[model samples]
Target: MKKNSESKAGTSRRDFIKAGTAAAAGFMVVPRHVLGGAGFVAPSDKLVIAGIGVGGKGESDLKSFHDSGKAEIAYLCDVDDRRAAGSVQRFPKAKYYKDFREMLDKEHKHIDAVSVSGPDHNHAIHALPAMQLGKHVYVQKPLTHDVYEARVLTEAAKKYKVVTQMGNQGASGDGVRIMREWFDAGLIGDVHTIYTWTDRPVWPQGIQWPAQKAEVPKELDWDLWLGTAPYKDYVDKLVPFNWRGWWDYGTGALGDMGCHIMEAPFSILGLQYVKDVQASVGTVYVDEFKRGYFPESCPPSSYAVLTFPKTDKTPGDVKIHWMDGGIQPERPEELGPNEVFGDGGNGILFVGTKGKMMAGCYAENPRLLPTSLTEQHKLPVKYERVPGGASGHYAQWVEACIAGHGKKEVSSPFSIAGPLTEALLMANLAIRGSDLRIDNRYPGRNLKLIWDNQNMKVVNFDEVNQFVKREYRQGWELPTV
Candidate 1:
């Protein structure tokens, strides 16, 4: 594990400095007095940011933060130079490094925050160390790879008192707020059932890992790319995006889209931690009568149901059904037979006693079913709309980080994002459990896995616990409190 002052297990910050690494390296820790008093804003202050996994979504995140003007891109890090090309070109002035640990170790004194947009497996590894350094962190969705990491990061955020944000931009969108207003106005009375669906895993899934090993590409550091995942030979097409299908690197379709599509309902209903979960997964048959078994990959498709006990905002237990891999719920009767059902490809539907309402990805274009009701009904807007809506998510985090912890409110801080992520990962536990085979029989099939949220485990099933907190590869371990 990387030693840091923030880690309870490592040498304290004061001790590390006194030991002479700071002196020998000439590392200068910025004094709090220079950053100003708590909650006191210096008009000239700008947050210095470091980007970990600077490619694709990571590239976009960096641009958005730079666009905010309140944040400066001081460093960029990624294992694959090919993926990092665009960002390196775009931010030529920012120092670049291939390993985040090296960058953080050498530049922690200079960075005020870190943006983690790496693959799902390494999110916690990158974000936790930064938080330990007292630097604010902006981690992308599916907050962590396992249930345990989500809980660890959540608790660490509070322990370190750092401003943290999850990159679920929809949390900053107006549609969720509008839906919240509608729900509060009783337009959709007591939503007991909700459905979120997506057409993802467009890449390969329900398939076997490539049997043929290929030479590692020159631009990519295959070992570093693997990060916390167990070592494996490099394979074609897995580097850029196909990693999403493998359980070793990604969280499948649900992890890819759940944070966005589920945010609105989660926010409007004040939902968190699940009580139990059950799932039915779609399988690919290799032959006329035999089903193909690819334990290493995410299934081609899956439909999971999660039960969340009543919260302050909910009238009773809420049942959330998640469908992915082009699987969607039945269209509401009020929707025109020819009319689109939630932007045609993906959507969220809420069934309440009074009516039904639905929205597309990111909770965009939310509408009360029967279309006419959306136009005719207007409720008082009780929630303050986010400035610039979804687009402002980056700027909001930048401003909040600059303002320091607790100085401003953020839409998807880890406190909320952690529970939301854990709930989704819990659903995955059921999906994975459904695939367990015992004596040619599906031992875990169709069973409701009771969950002990406080304990973070399946109360009735031990088989699914393997996924609750995955074991990191020999070299990488999640930090302890």
Candidate 2:
């Protein structure tokens, strides 16, 4: 097992100093204080931000950015006006709009940044335009509705020269950073397999089918809510919150939670691409009496296996297994007595050659193995603490905007997130049908899938690739990458 801070593992303080100096030389500007809050400005001096989706997560985003004091609310846009009422009330000074484009066109100069907290499909639509306008963007997790869109947004951010951050805020946390430090220190030797699962029973699992059409609420915009997605009659069950389980709107359990649980291993291990992936889905269960928007029936619970080849940077193979619908992997005995596994719906379990490590969703406080080793582990004596929690994520992005800082070399840029999203999105594809095999490595193989990041298509499977990128209804197309 590797040593923790208590044990003084790997690099010494002097070595870290040399490394830090080298890193500093690569970047032209240096802050007045290396570890102090000198480079950032007060929230009052921060830029003006608009919210594209001001319901659900969007509401939370408003509070986070507002609390940062680094941004002023300039606009609130949501298709469902009723859902946005609270936000509209909170920011009376900020204009409210049912459509985002109207707000963007009229208040273009007044907005300095945008928070995209819409459904997975709508994220790219709102974010791309904002970035194209040189507005900094803070988009929610899973980045895009489809794999191709993720790539487009990443490229656009590069061309526009804007500061960008995905909603997977856990990626910026101290716990996540500590996880990286431990891995680099070789605490877990040659990690080859990982298990991630979520017991998301709240929303029904699988795309069994849609329930019967019901009266659309008087206050909701049914047509607008269905933006970009296929035209479907309004159903009471599908609206408000349960849209995630449906194929047309949400990405089911994996897409919904993958970014959160998959982040630790992806960041700490530098997992770049998936070599192959296959999934076995449960039977589709249907509810005869369609209440709200969703049909009562749903697909059976699912289990998927993702195989990742060794990359140039990480030369060891890794396997990621996902479990959902009240299922979990067999706990390893090595965790020892008095060890409590995470009780939450999502958790990550890492098994290295020497020891094991596990962290909860959102990269909260993690627990390491060999309880006795805890005392022996010596972490890097010197470290920098970035802000934490949801508020901190927004704070960092706002700070970057004011400082004119761009993407970090090792950070989770849109380029990285795009592909990461693609891999996760494939799991959703596999669960949709059976006997589908994906070989992302090359096109020569018969099962080859070639991705045109710009067009968002798989050349061979035009029909299937069409699903990779979505089509926008009139007036809703996200800007081209």
Candidate 3:
């Protein structure tokens, strides 16, 4: 947290670490800083991190960063003190602020990086300023609430020259690396089809917004919590969770789980910016003889077909079939009926000319068709594995940022994460468009949206394009950079 300038003449913790690591062989004693206890500081290469939305997963994220042994939890920011209570107690020495703007304004210089585990809607707002200030950022998966925001964050990372990572730990997993090596080895020659499914929306979806409003809690700043989204009356059970099902807040199932499940094919095949997408969403009824279209709420279940332009690793166009809400593709003939497919609740499968392969959530437990080939196949490792695999994800970003951008490789940097998130958001566009009632008919359900990636618009469906970049409310504005 020293005032290390971003220039050759300046001595940063990055430089400090590089010097120590280089001379490590000759060192006989453990560094004093490394052995320092809680709230340790100075004379070390420990990265200083300020966390936004430091609650629940946010708390765990900071803990993981500290567990890296090279990071210090320097600050915590969250709108809901109730949710942030645990992290506040754990990192009591770290400064605490209710509004991120205040913390960033007063302490930006003291922090080396920022981690965002806020709602999807506020991701871009929380992450952009830190990057603009030249601090590294680690935001949660499905990087932003909208496709345009994802693209903006992607460009900003490069513009500001900061290390960036999206929290899809699977992207850093050995399973994904194994699958990539297998594909490179031609074990699943020329993948043409893919299926990624999840049994999610464990919270509420396909329901009407509550008519009754609840009084805002004493410890929560409802306005700050609703950053960028339109003003809505405070409702019970919406905060901390259940926000995922609403359009104004969360991106529903696809936004929640797509990045984790779909990342395998994307990484292996180099898929980017989906060209066309179509979807079918399950219906939710209000009562008997009353089939209602609840556009405000995400459909309980849905299936979407996304087509990606062929990459050098593929034979032809690639179509990824995405299913959620327990809907799954028919089992492959090679697998036994009793055997679980994709850990029972979630999975991803790649169908290729020579064979097929599949993996569970986070691309874990990758196996070739017939289950017998999973262990028998002999393939040379083409890529390096992340030390500690998925669990090492937070540490990877911590080290990469401490080493400065481009000094160390991170699996899900925004350059890679942006497009991955954008594709899934585009799928969300199709999902939301499904219930659109125009001319007394639902056209979105039958339409195949042709995406204009350059413009960030759905060229064919003008109505759905509004979602590409949602209108911000609550006196907040999106970042200009």
Candidate 4:
């Protein structure tokens, strides 16, 4: 009774190949009998899932998986019972818990996958254990809270031989795929620079910081929500969406939207890692002690410049400029007056030697410059539909899971996404006043000002390396790579 043969009865040829691959990789390939004479079990075949931090983003992620119809929601876990109540109601059949570890321990055998949509700090804790147990994972973007954790999760996904997908849904969009094709086809010649901007005006930028003595919300589990992050008082301004502007719970403007706006360039250009990053932060509008809860001292605004060294596969060099909190880079005059710019919170502008292309957030509805560029330089008709929608993204991950393909099979697997995330995370570091230079040639070089990723520490700058790996609260240490 070979596992592959037993599972191949009614499975698609592709799925059969996938299952065999998973077995080869040493993942547990359980073959159960199908009740119906249908000959094959559905991919969902007894798949049970757990949801961690089921609140705003977590709720949305749960719905996506539920709609897939490929898995049963078995557990809803959130530190805040109030936040998890709605999700519990939605999936009344599922058990509920506050600590993910407890859920994993009690229901370990019953769970097949986990959706980690917690705050940036807790993303790793929820996803890592599941991957260790060979459970598939679908974590939201800016995948990990820190650069080191991003690399850790990527490695663990491989070590555990489990299916993994990051929740940057735009990576699966048709428009985004077109951007990749256009770049690969040389429409965007020798990509030297890219610009992404966001106008996240939330949380009342430039206002006086709230006092630290404010009473914590009764319905919110502040301690549990703070999981791996350092302890801080409960403040109304830090709850819900305001967390995005704060350093403790979120990654400010860049991390908040980098995965969305930066996905196009990251996917299209095959960006490796940051070479160097510097920033010009704004003046603080509020008192430092009053706003100590957040990362930045300024009025929630900054501009940062990032450089990427050329790889043998990539051309000359590439520079990415990020503008956040209503800042926009000075558009080059070469783009022309008629060219459209992104109006919403996010946009990506690509300037190539041959022509230019611009797209809205998530690379939606991209248009070539000069309008005529579209007609003159059209992508192959066959490649037109390659990138589709978010549903396709989820579907791709599920298919890979059922087939046993590792995370690398997906477009934005952690291997590719990890470095892109590192680059973006560096931007956050730069904005935080770290004087660090990235050396892609060899990571983690100890040069006083240079970062060496290979060594996993900053050259001559222990402070910078310390920044790379944050201090987790007791019992929340991230696994070292």
Which candidate number maximizes TM-score?
A: 1
Off by over 4 Å in 4: 1-46, 204-209, 212-214, 286-299, 334-339, 381-388, 434-449, 460-462
- Candidate 3 per-residue lDDT over residues 244-360, each given as its tens digit: 999999999999999999999989999988999999899977889999777789999999999999888776799999999999999999889998898899999999889999999
Model 4 per-residue lDDT tens digits across residues 1-481: 0012223212222222232223212233333332223464544463467888888888877876777776577899888877787898899999988767667655654666788887787888667756665577888888987888887887876666667788888788887877777777877677788899988646654343467657766777677788787886676666666766556567777776888888888777777877677676554424645422233322467788788888653677788889988888776565567555764557888888887788888888886775467667676744434223756676666556666654236767777777877888877766654322345232222221345777655455454566688888865555332
What lDDT would each prediction earn against the true structure? 0.86, 0.67, 0.86, 0.68
TM-score of each predicted structure versus truth = 0.93, 0.80, 0.91, 0.82
Model 4 poorest ten-residue lDDT run: 1-10
> What is candidate 2's local distance difference test score?
0.67
Candidate number with greatest lDDT = 1
**436: Cα error in model 2, Å:** 8.2
Worst 10 residues of 3 by lDDT: 23-32
Per-residue lDDT of candidate 2, residues 1-481 (tens digit): 0000111111222222233223212111112122134353333466688998898888988888888887788789888888898899889998888766556656654567889887776777678766755577888888887766776776776776777888777776776777677777888877889898887646865444645778888877777677667787887677677877766677777877888778878877777656556566555323565422222223346777777777553657888898877678887676665565654567888888878877778677676775456557769833355656434777777777766644333245676676678778766555543423245232222343433444544455444554666666654555444
lDDT of 1 at 328: 86
Model 4 clash number: 14
lDDT, candidate 2, residue 109? 46
Least accurate stretch of 10 residues (summed lDDT) in model 1? 1-10
lDDT of 1 by residue, 1-481 (tens): 1111243423333333333223223234443334454554434467888999999999999999999988789899999999999999999999999877678668876777899998999999888877877789999999999999999999988988888999999999999998888888999888999999999979899898889999998889888899789999999999788998999999999999999999888899989899999999999999999889988999999999999999998879999999998898988899999988987889999999999999999999999989889989887778998888999999999988877788889999999999999998998899899987768878889799999988888988898899999988765666565
